[model samples]
Target: MDVGVILLTLVCYALACLLWWQLHTPVFLLCLLSGHVGALASPLWVLLYGVTYRADLGVWFDVLGQPVYSSVVIASAWFYPLPALIILYLHRVRWLGARYTIALLTFLVMAIYHFIIETIGLGLNIWSYDAAPLLPFGLSHGLISTALAATISMVLLYTVLVVQRFSLISMVLSLVPATLVFSLMIQGVLGAPFWVSLRFAESQSWVLIIGMLSTLGLLGWAVHIIAWGMDHMNWELV
Candidate 1:
């Protein structure tokens, strides 16, 4: 067994369980996972970038008379976005059936989460925000990051729920793609490039268009496979 993958699977399951309990539905799991994925990956990106790029800077920059770019400053970012997502997801998933309302609410909560993380990030001097302040809600990048991820997650979850009711096996496999994405995210946790932002930019119609098509293709295939099992294998819902 791949222990690492197994552990991630367990984590995803636990997250699904938690989200379902609060929301009384499983329709928000995708967004919840995405939000957590972003939060987890962001700090890693900051740390990797710090080590990889710190040498480029001439010397230590001081903030509040403290050298702000130290290793702790570089490393502390790992804790944000992740916890914030879990907390916000738990609160927001309960509104899953609200459609546009849920989307807006999730976006609002995630925006605040991103804002706080970026604000703290700037304060620690781990990274500089283009916004030029350690205040949350003042950064467009922050809002865009959280809002976009949340939106995608909601769509994934809603589609999954509408197409097939969750069962033990479906629930297990439902997370495979997200698990893979999370693993890739973990592997690339190092500082985000403009490309990462570009890939996630909420306004990128092309990406959204591609994502919708890809999601439909993938989901269609998955439902077909599930139907095969239901028809031929005598699979029963748990």
Candidate 2:
């Protein structure tokens, strides 16, 4: 990692801690930790994508001959969780009247936020995708893929953390749904069904639709469990 990136990450971490203090929600740390784990776990999916599609997600900077970028990593792990945490805090305090409403709105807001950041990042050559397909008016597959993946991961992380008490087990379990949804979204964007996408082959539309619905159903059930846990368990700062 570059020295500047490391310094900036520390500064961001400090600000995050300060935000946690001001918000009086120690769950901020847990959410941040979950985001970090999610980001770290991304390399596995990145490798799979690279092998399956020959695409590179991003390359802001490299460290130790690896494609990891510290600035992006820090943003994804730290800053990305702030909006979700704020929304969750509001919901927890009853300022937000409905959980599902807050959840849906949060997801939309985060998706647009990430999409804008990705557009700027692409313009600045912070990253590039290989032979990316263009959408209307020339938006590339890279921008859409990154934005959607990041947004889904953020919202899922927030939902899981809010619904379940903070614990190692809960955090790890959260990754299950998050990763599953992420993989499904990416495969959809890549124009393939789940199994065929993994094999880097073409897929039928019906198969794609079925896979997406099934995965969404599974993810919805996981979220329901989280919601039930939230209502039944008296969550506390650990």
Candidate 3:
């Protein structure tokens, strides 16, 4: 199972590299960069959520190693970049035009993406959700936080790449902010309520429930704000 996880991560990197080699576009370059950034920034997710890593799966940099909640492993890197690539592709091609539509689709698609990834990770014993999960599939606030982060990140990407038409250098630099956006979203904006509840109300199920609900509400509002910005914001700023 550990080998499977390793192979999967390698395969993803290979695919991303292959795609970049073929297209040689800024979009694909950003995708590859996203993987590297995600690798470094992923520990923020671990810090905000309840997750435990398998002893055998392997760790690259152990940010936190408490027995109950472990830091991210090497396999964590591949997950977010793929979704970033996909969401950016959808935006680049203008597949979904309406802000709300794109927002909803992005959220659902990222959710499903993480769902499949988490399923494999959980099935293979690479990682386990030890926190208060609202669902059996371990689709807890922790997982939802990443999806929401992806969604928010997409909005920023669209603004920079699509709306503002920034130069290649600017686009490259945008990667840092893009990466930080995920960390901010997970650690502060959307993950805070659930994380606070997780810490203080471990025994109270209802408190966790409220926290999840509040997080969901914030997610919806975020989507709305992204959509509204796209619809009405003056894109004239240089």
Candidate 4:
């Protein structure tokens, strides 16, 4: 990890902590938690895709021969949730008002932000993809994929908020939209039919993607249930 990246990440983490203290809503906390969880879980996807795409993590520093990119991953977990919290705050203050409207707006904001950050990183040689995926209009390694992934993760977290009871079954079902959207986006971008695309990918990649998705879905659902249960218990005690 670059010293600069470490310092910047710490500053951002401090700011996030301060913001959380000031706002302190269950919904906001949940969003923060979800983002961190997603970030932590992203290595599954990264490792799977490493067979084809390689990311340059800015610097070559290592800990016990392990790349310091782990720090970057941890920092990203906190950073990803900031947008969702902001959108939710806007809604709480009656600025956005509608749930679906907030959801759409939040997705757009996050997608654009992801694109900008990714472009900058690529320009700085902070990361590069090997055998890059194709995008519309003959572009390669477009940031849209990352944006879509982030949006899907946030949407899944948001779905938990709208539900009265979080269950494994409900969580699995809620993933359908995100899974479908992601699959279609990748398929369209790569200009490959869905079944053909899977056939081309290594079998291990399929297993990893499936495992990662399932793990994330279960983790998000667990967090929602735990948070809700705590709230319910507090109400009962009162």
Cα RMSD (angstroms) for every candidate in the order listed: 13.0, 6.8, 4.7, 10.3
Q: Indicate which candidate wins on lDDT.
A: 3
Which parts of model 1 have CA positions greater than 4 angstroms off? Answer: 1-96, 126-140, 152-164, 179-238
lDDT (CA) for every model shown? 0.40, 0.49, 0.57, 0.45
TM-score of 1: 0.36
| Residue 192, candidate 1: C-alpha displacement in angstroms | 13
Candidate 2 residue lDDT tens string, 55-141: 343455443334654455665554456566655656556565434444445556766766776666667565555432223335455
Residue 161 of candidate 4: its Cα lDDT?
41
- Could you tell which candidate, 1 or 3, scores higher by lDDT? 3
How many clashing residue pairs are found in candidate 4?
Answer: 0
Question: What TM-score does prediction 2 earn?
Answer: 0.56
Superior candidate under TM-score, 3 versus 4: 3
Q: Rank by lDDT, descending?
A: 3, 2, 4, 1
Q: Name model 3 segments beyond 4 Å from true.
A: 1-24, 64-77, 90-99, 131-160, 230-238
Pairs with backbone N, CA or C atoms under 3 Å apart (clashes), candidate 2: none
Using lDDT as the yardstick, the better of models 1 and 4 is: 4
